[model samples]
Target chain A: MTADDGFDETLFELALRMGDNALILGQRVSAWCGHAPVLEEDIAMANVGLDLIGQTKLWLGLAGEIEGKGRSADDLAFLRADRAFRNCLLVEQPNVDYAHTLMRQYLFDAWHLPMLTALKQSAEPRVAEIAEKSAKEAAYHLERSSDLVIRLGDGSVESHERMQAALNALWPFTGEFVAPDDVDKAAASRGLGPDLSAIAERYNETTAAVLRDATLSAPADAPVRKGGKEGLHSEHLGYLLSEMQWLQRSHPGAQW
Target chain B: MTAAGTLPSEKDIWRWLEDVPDPEIPVVSVVDLGIVRDVAVDKGGAVVTVTPTYSGCPATAVIAMEIETALRKKGLDPVRLETRLSPAWTTDWISDEGRSKLKEYGIAPPVQGTSCAGAMKQANATVACPRCGSENTEEISRFGSTPCKASWRCRDCLEPFDHFKSF
Candidate 1:
């Protein structure tokens, strides 16, 4: 039998989800390349995007190897349909402004830092390896984003308002990241994936502390909104894919 | 350097690696920068395992080539190379001599005693000037000429320099 013939699909699905989060978030953050408020901010955001894309490449490469597919990382990244993407809706959302980008990054980085740290002990050596590396990068990412959240939130009235608004708008989607599901459950049972819920408390504690220091409060509460894990995404993802994949789709197998 | 039909020992292999300088920062060797992960000596040849400083750092390909060429020139044939992504390369891996060399080269080394994740909560440490040894430096940008560095300027020295990022 082939690698996928008799194996449980949860591992592949989990890996896809992990990669999609990084890839889509990378694209979103990269959108600010030329538009950032200052040169230093521009360079910083680009560095963050580069790190995310690098992590994506590693996760997808492992996914392809485990599936025994002839497909390489590029094929998986450029050839997939928008519906097939498993990234969170939060990552695919448009970058409305610098505050929005920072808030989104702050939320995700908090979750990513701890999740990757715990995943370093995964049963799958490849997964553990990827996590070990990503945890380091994610740490730096968290540091930058968290620092910005505090700076902007406490800087001026307008800046604080913008950051607060972004937090309110994005709060609902943060829930899905730590929400338990069957795939995550199976991975947790096999010791291949860390329980995201257990890590959620840590993520929450960290985010709350930053928010307090920033002089801005998180949204009081919101319903747990989710969908991207099941190949479902916001309308924004379709447009993003069209823009990202246009060149590749227009000319099949084109090389730089 | 080796003579014809004679195998190089582990000592010779490591010495050759130490002589191979980093492609981007030629001031330091790969071993001093801590990218050379493993050097395994076999009967016929040696296998070297390296970890790239960053995944997409352009210098990595050049690094692999430099390692091979350095070994090949020493009469070592078929020196196999492998890249490891796990336990990602950290600035903490830089040797004490490497740190001193970086300072002499006008680049501030990473702050000691900080890991990637914990770096977030730790308040900014004093970044001393490599040229004047002053603790008055302000980071200009989080990224610099290379993936592993940040751009900073010293208030006292009035000179811009690259600070090797902690991660």
Candidate 2:
């Protein structure tokens, strides 16, 4: 197929990455809908989840539109198999504890802020538009997560230990965020994506500062896992997709 | 008591809606916020579809009421307002003309690249003062009175202004 007729698999992959991140994270957040550490935090987490779900819908819808397929956002999100998902391993990880969730959010938000900033200047107007809008919400998510991390890290001996442990556990997965893949390079060449390497540096600095403020040390770097962008995900993704897609698969085209 | 020539069309309903200012901004109308997504008319009544700027935005209820009220006052008593959340709302939906109007209303419009990372940079970057049109401005706080705004102070004019959050 000529370049014009040829599908841009790279762009499609990038969109899937974004959509999966939002969808998975949103699902995790929604788990705390009626059960938060506090009432205010409960509402706050729910609001954040709502924002993420909204973002997921937009990204998935765009993905469908770009693919020129008849698949709707629901089809892309709730009808796909686990191996077909492109979400990061970090997002798919379970929300073990409040500290764990906060740590994961802090790390993800730290990386996402810079990545979205770069994406706002994307050559693709749709991607840029979504990035521009999402960046604002991500800023709030980062701030709130930062505040929680600092509080937990400095609160009590147990709290501090838990927060530190969470940080250590999550550190390895972070390496995947900055490591550029074929999709990243392709989008960067077309100005439709951000330079992940530059974003990585900024992410490291910002996250390091936050950890330092919380009296927590950064975890040592470890081997990074790849393949999420290639539709290869962790074992946890199968369970997630099964749950998310069960209703859609069971009752085809069912609507509330 | 109809004081007009004929019944308003869907487009006319939207045009008349121009007079309904946003309850919060007052200066900017709902149309400018991109909240008024679509307007349609049928034999039963007119349907005005609006998507909330934010999911938890308290202004949505008021805006819906305002739309119904405004239409009713124009003798469209059976006006129906619907809310849609599927596509989601984005600040990019705000038009250039709308941004200018927001600026003129003394509310510092959200900058072009208003993402979280960009906003953090904005906290340190030089922002034009809404009052004096100077580039000397400092962020007072990231969280403003509402979730949708940020507080800033201009050094030249020494006046505090609200910058609409870019989201």
Candidate 3:
């Protein structure tokens, strides 16, 4: 509990942002249910999605509790509008192909590892609890994606080119993870969140190592894209929200 | 007070829980699987602390309901199942009994001391076959029939088996 009410809201909002990333990405992964390249991969990826959605429940569950609005995790996940979402744009982007999916996963896993590791020391016990729990899963996910990236990038002509292209297109989105903003400032000043600067360095270094192993070159530095946290997102997020929320909206209060 | 028998002791409740088999693996009990982390009889009621095998295993709800059903069947009033996920559930928590049961039931038990992330780098990590007891085995797939197990086949016996993933 902070003395400042505004700070508390920012903290809660931060949780929402974090949860949105997991939920949206998980949803995207789930869409690959029967369509993954292979049967084993289908199961593995869906399991990964399931883990993320489970984590989403924990984060949004806590956020709902903190907000004290009588809303449940499902309420927060299903009822929220596109403009209200605060996930990083990378997560909400369409899964163009396996290459893009793996690339985006690898990138986020890089950030997720350090950010969650640092968050294990959060002032809020609940935040720390979720962080501690999430870090293990995050590590394994990174391992899988990291291994895949290497295999795909170094595998064959077709795979290598596809992976390289995916990396090139997605690298810019990694910037928003550590870029400081209002929520970052509030969380950092109060020791409620990770020190983003240190995590930023680790994330970049980790990504570089993985890319090197994959024999892929980092994309040339360019203007970094931003603003999913502030609720301004690309056109992709709207369509994603429409599909995700369609059932909830069409059949209000529907429960299995 | 509602005409059921007297409440069982915490120890007795734990013993009672041993009869409730896991919904997925019917050969092993939930307590043996380590999902029922703690059981207590407090002034308020009986509180059973649980940690699920994996975060997303659909079996969690079924296991919780089975726990409550068993408790109610025994007349334990106001039962509470609290999910504690901090330390997280790992294969190491599977009781010795659970491991043996898994093997006898045609599943290779998880290799302890290796975390799931540790196996991630080496996805096809070798394991002994439950049927042939041969160490020369290869993972058929990283994912098995269930979320917790990996499909493996023994080279020597040429028989397929399931290895409980340690994640």
In terms of lDDT, the best-performing candidate is 3
| Per-prediction DockQ | 0.58, 0.13, 0.60
Q: lDDT tens string, model 3, A96-206?
A: 999999999999999988898898999888899888888888887887788899999989999999999998898889899999898888888898997789999998788
The 10 consecutive residues of candidate 1 chain A with the worst lDDT sum are A1-10
Candidate 3 wrong stretches, greater than 4 Å: A1-7, B1-6, B43-45, B119-126
Per-residue C-alpha lDDT of model 1 across residues A143-218, encoded as one tens digit per residue: 7788889999999999999999999999889988898788888889899898887888997899889999999887
Clashing pairs in 2: A135-B115, A135-B116
Report the lDDT of model 1 for residue A254: 95
- Shift in Å, residue A5, candidate 1: 2.8
TM-score for each prediction? Answer: 0.92, 0.71, 0.94
- Specify the CAPRI tier of model 1: medium
Residue runs of model 2 more than 4 Å from their true location after superposition: A1-4, B1-52, B55-167
What docking grade applies to model 2?
incorrect
Per-residue lDDT of B10 in model 2: 69
Better of 1 and 2 by DockQ: 1
**Clash pairs of candidate 1?**
none
Candidate 3 clashing pairs, residues 3+ apart or interchain = none
Q: Which candidate is the best by DockQ?
A: 3
Please report how far candidate 2 places residue B1 from its true position, in Å.
Answer: 16
